[model samples]
Every structure is written in structure tokens, then in C-alpha cells.
Target: MYDRFLVSKQIDQWLAEDIGGGDLTAQLMIDPRATATFAMNAREPMTLAGVEVAGLVFTRYEPACRIEIHAHDGATVERGALLMTVSGPAQALLTAERTALNVVQRLSGIATETAKYVRAIAGTKARLLDTRKTTPGLRMLEKHAASCGGALNHRLGLDSGVMLKDNHIAVCGSIMEAVKRARLRVPALTKIEVECDRLDQVEEALAAGADVIMLDNMSLETMRQAVALVDGRALLEASGGIRLDTIAAVAATGVDYISTSRPFQSAPAVDIGLDEA
Candidate 1:
């Protein structure tokens, strides 16, 4: 759902932020007609992502730039694999280098990290999920990378789905009232999920007819009970405190989905660099 219009707009913002008042360094050091080719390669294993958008960064400056994407998104690339090649104006290459590398490295890191979580829950009915914990303006791209790494997207934003969190419940005074109001306000196609931190809240949420029930940071015993309590009435999601070391047990507890913030919030950028080709 990330359209070119949006991507281009964001790219404009990035370029404006990074290249304000012209790239005087490039202006001083480079000739306008100087054309060169650059190759982007991985320094470590990664689930390839952002190649296309990274290409866009170059083209955004030099529209006629030649871009060859050797590795597409979701492809697993080994160390030293060539991800892409760009041949264009020397100034364009220099101007686009940092922004392009930052985007691809950050996104590839997320995709590669998410691959671990996906593999951990493989062969199970439980699906891996990503939360709203994403970079403010880059959620679209980041979520796309998560999907590339094999996790399904949850709510894209607050407007995309009806989710009643702890604060919403606290304000509404009870899960029943919060859900009832949301059910009346939203269309039938929209799913209403409630976040319950306690066992008693789980039953109350179930009774309120929420479409999905999230067990937030519950113990293994409590999660099992929550799944049984759900009993096919709603989709069960386990969130909070999920880690690579702990995700398998959480998945085994019969949660329909496992959500974590690590992929978006904590994944280190992959080491990929651009060099003259």
C-alpha cells in the first residue's frame, strides 16, 4: 500500500533535509558531466530489502540513472553479495549515497532480524506479527521489510483497526463499554481487538465480543488459560516481553500470533556499502 507518490514525497523531504542549500561539496569537487557507476554490496548476511527504494534515491536526483537490482527484497544474500548497481551523474551518486545506504541498511537489518523470529515459530499455526512500534515516518517501508522477513502486518495505524489498549479501557471504565462503543462506531469488516494484561480482563474482553484478544505479557500458564478461554471465539495474540530466546515457548502456548517490537525498535543496521564499480 506504499504508493510511489508517498515514497517520492518522503524522498523529497529526505533530500531537502540532507541536501539543503545544495551539496556545495559535490558542487566544488565534481563536474556536472562526470558519470560513474557504483556497486552496493553486503558485508554480512541479510534478508535483502530496500533495494528498490534505494534505487529511487539515486533516480530521485538523476531520473535517467541506470539501476540494476541484483538482489530483490526478501532474498537472502550472503556476505559479499552484490545487491544493486547504479550508473549515473557523479554528483547524483554522491548526493544519494548516505540517504540510500541508511535506508537499505536499516530496512535490511529489520528484515534479517525478523527472519529469526519467523524461523523460530515455523511449522506452528501461530503467526509472527509486528506492532505499531515503528519509525514515525517510515512505518510503511519498515512494515514492508517485516513482511519481507515473513511476519504479517498487524494494524498499519490507529485508523486501520480498532484496538482497545489498557489506557482506552481505563478511560472507558471497562472493557465491555470500550468494545461496545467501538463496535457501534466501526464497520463489521473492521476487527476490534482488546488488550488484556490480567486473566479476569481476558474473560471480560471475551464476554464483550472483541474480535481479537491480546494477552499482554502474561505468564505461560496464564497465556495457556487465555487461549483456552478464547476457545475459538477470537484470535489470540501474545505481546510484550517477546524475545528470540523466549518466543518459541510463547508460540507453543497456542497464541494465534506473537507480536514484538524488537525488529523495528532494536535491530542493528546491516553493514552494506556502496563502492565504485
Candidate 2:
């Protein structure tokens, strides 16, 4: 989740990046004293996520702008739904339009994509999880969008947990060694997860007392085998090769959670427009 202060900081930087020097078109064509109003509308169905953030972007540019939000975050809206309306100095509104739309569109797209995956895995024990594969400067915002779509958040960063992957295992010589080192270094309450692509490694990770075991890219049969092998000794997460087409099947394999980056990495921006009201 993002606080107003944090969101404001990000919006400020984005505005600076976008409107450096000045908005040439707005400055050249619009009178500073002229006022105008615009409505933000959804051009397609989407799970909205950042309506308020969009408001923040607009207000950051012009504090006196009056914004009326018609749709809230996490709302599932149909095409042509009015999302927001803003009225302010014409130049200010025009200058802030793109940044505001960009934030809401991108976040809504991520939320919509996450909702699809969440729906796919419904009626199963497996919970949807968002990965760290987020836009670099927008991890918190992106993760917030994923949560808005009903997916649980995974580790926010490497510091959130100890995840021993192939490289770490290779460096430490084995899963056991890697987990041991991590356990000693991390806080006493921190969980240690080990990524295992093979049943043999799953066994080793279980033996090493890993709190969470990630079944990385294993076949369904193998995943079932791993589930039976672990016997609830550790939480199992399915990762890699997970797609909308195969997510339900993966969930049926009985993993505790399914993790994917597709929702954030490849989700298409939702079509939204801010036009004269």
C-alpha cells in the first residue's frame, strides 16, 4: 500500500519528468486564466485501480482543481463508465492529463490482468500471488494493484525473505547448505524458501526445514508427486510456466499458492480517456 505522502512524491517526480521546463502545447495554445472541465471514461471493461492516485497526479499539478471521482479503486467497470471528472485552469488540466491517465491506465491494466488469473484459480486451495517482476520504480503501486484484484502479495524484495534459488544452491553446494546459511543470517522469525525444480531437490529442501518450497517449472505429475512427498511439511508455491491457459490446472496440482509475473510484466494498459466534459 502507498501513503499519500509517498504517492505525492512519486507523482511529483513523474510530473517533473513529463513537464520539464513547461508544457509547450498548453503554454502556447491555452490562456492561463481560462478554465475547462474533462471527464475520464473507461473505453473497455477493467478492474480499476488507482483512481485516487490519478486524482493525486492532477491535484499535484494544480492544487485548486476540483475532482469528482465517479468510480473508486477496485471497481469492476464496463466500457463507457465515467471514472472521474476534473475542472480547473485549462492549461493546468491539459498539462496534467497524460500523467494522470498513464498512472490509472497502467494500474487498472495490472489489476484487470490479476483478476483474470485470480478467477482462473478459484474454487481451489491455491491462492494467487504477485511476484517481484514489477515496473522498477512502481513496485508498491503495482503490488497494490495486484492486491486490488485479489492476489496475495509475495515477498516485496529479497530482504522480505530468504529464497534460495538455483544460483544460491549452486553457490552453497546444496539446498541444505544454502538454507542453513540463510537461517543463520536472517532474522529468527524470517521464513526461508527454497526453489526446487526437481523432486530430489524438493526432498532436500524439506529436509533442510525450508518454510516454503517453490516448485519451479515442474510438470503437473511431478508437482503432485512433490505435494505428496512434502505431505504438508512446508507450504508449496507453484512458479514458472504459469499462464492463464494453464493456471487452473496448476492450481489443481494442490500447491498452496501460484506465483506469476505476467499480470505486471505483460498486462496491456486499459483504454481510458480524459476528454472535455
Candidate 3:
């Protein structure tokens, strides 16, 4: 769960979006004091996430509403499995359902996809990692779900680490120049990673004291050669064109980490449904 303030703010925005001026249907047809119980179910198999956020939605509308989650975060559930049961004012439940389910379903989808990648690389030296291609406001929640699914999160933001990409290299003119400039400008404790698209750049990065080198969009043969060239002087990472079917092969190349945006960006939203109990 995120901070209460953050959750509240998000909930407030969602409520405003949903209600607009008011829930005209609820006001027109439902009694103010009417209450009901509902069950949340998975319409398709998925990993669970955002349970607490869902509870927050219920709380925002009906402060006394009770939510009980039968399935835990990070737990895998089959289709039609009961995720949680909520009892609250009918209007509030109706208002909050979509927003709550939206968060859980999307995040669980990311977690589920990430879990597959993590499982694919099991027993390999390579670690599964997520890239910066995360949803704007939901980065924290998405990354949290990725961690739950057993993938290590890369830099949460640019401030967390110094990663010199191709554009940075182009602007600075060379990998070594970028690394040197970054080292001189940034703090001593800042870890530096340089993206190398070619095997020749690997030696330059290592020589320039790059702590980690990303082998972007390289073939397995090239990645293996890069790893061999690195020779443990710096941590090696393979990025780009990674898919579930291809991750194991990439991991087998002896790289320390494999990063991709697929788990967060391309994952289909896990199906979930709300049913009146």
C-alpha cells in the first residue's frame, strides 16, 4: 500500500471523475442509507495486486465500509476465484468499484507478466529487471507489483543511478567521454552504467570505470562475446527485444541482468469482475 495521503488524493480525483457533480443514478434510484455486500472475482487467471488500494476506494465513499481480501497480493488466482468481499453503502460501492478494479487489474497484469519473465530465467545468473517504461503516475505501484512477481526494479527515476544512453553518448561524443564527464559532474558514490550497442564499446566503458554496461539490442552471440570481453570487470546487462520465449536464451549468455519494458508496458490488463454478493 502507498501512503494514506497519496491514496486519498488519488481516490479523491477518481471520485471526482466518476461522480462529476454527483452520481445521478444512485441519487435518483437508491436510498442514502441502503447497504449491500459484493464480491470481487477474477474473470481470468492472474496475480493479485492493489488490494489495499481497493479498500481505500471503499473507505473514501463510505468511511465505515468493511473490505476483506480473501486473496493476498502476489497470490495467483484462477478464473472465477473470489478476490475479496466488500460490504458498504450501495451507492458508495457502485461508485468505487471501477476505480478500484482498474488499479488492481492493471497492476496484477504487470505482476503476472513479470512473474513469467522471472520464472523463465530461474537458475540463470541473469536477474530479471524492469525498465523506465512504466505508467506515469502508477510507477511506484507497478514497480512494487514487479518486485512481488520476483523481478528486480531498475532505477525508479534518473536520480537513482547514472545511465549513459546512446543519445547521451552522441551528445558527449563517446562512451568514455560520457562516463568521464558524468564521473566528474556527479557525486563519487553515484554508480554509473553505460549502454553499449557494440562489443568495441564494452572495452571503452570498462576502461572508463563504468560500474555496469548495458548490451542493448545485441544478438546472443554478441552478448556472449561482450560478457567474455567484460571478463567480470564490470556488471553486464542485456536489454531490448526480450520476450518470454527469448528471455531464457538471453539469460544463458552469462549477463548479470536483463531489462525490458514489456512486462510493464505491453502486458494486457488482467480480467477482474465485480459481483453483488
Highest-lDDT candidate: 2
Question: Taking the tens digit of each residue's C-alpha lDDT, what string does model 2 give over 100-132?
Answer: 999999999999999999999889999999999
Q: What is the lDDT of residue 130 in candidate 2?
A: 94
For residues 201-272, write the lDDT of model 1, one tens digit per residue: 999999999989999989999999998878989999999999999999999999999999899998999999
**Estimated TM-score for each candidate:** 0.97, 0.96, 0.94
Error of 2 at 197 (Å): 0.7
Q: Report the number of clashing residue pairs per model.
A: 0, 0, 0
Write out the backbone clash pairs for model 1.
Answer: none
After superposition on all C-alphas, the RMSD of every candidate to the true structure, in Å, is: 1.2, 1.2, 1.6
Error of 3 at 94 (Å): 0.9
lDDT of 1: 0.93
User: Candidate 1 vs candidate 3: which has greater lDDT?
Assistant: 1
lDDT of 3 by residue, 35-58 (tens): 999999999888777777787888
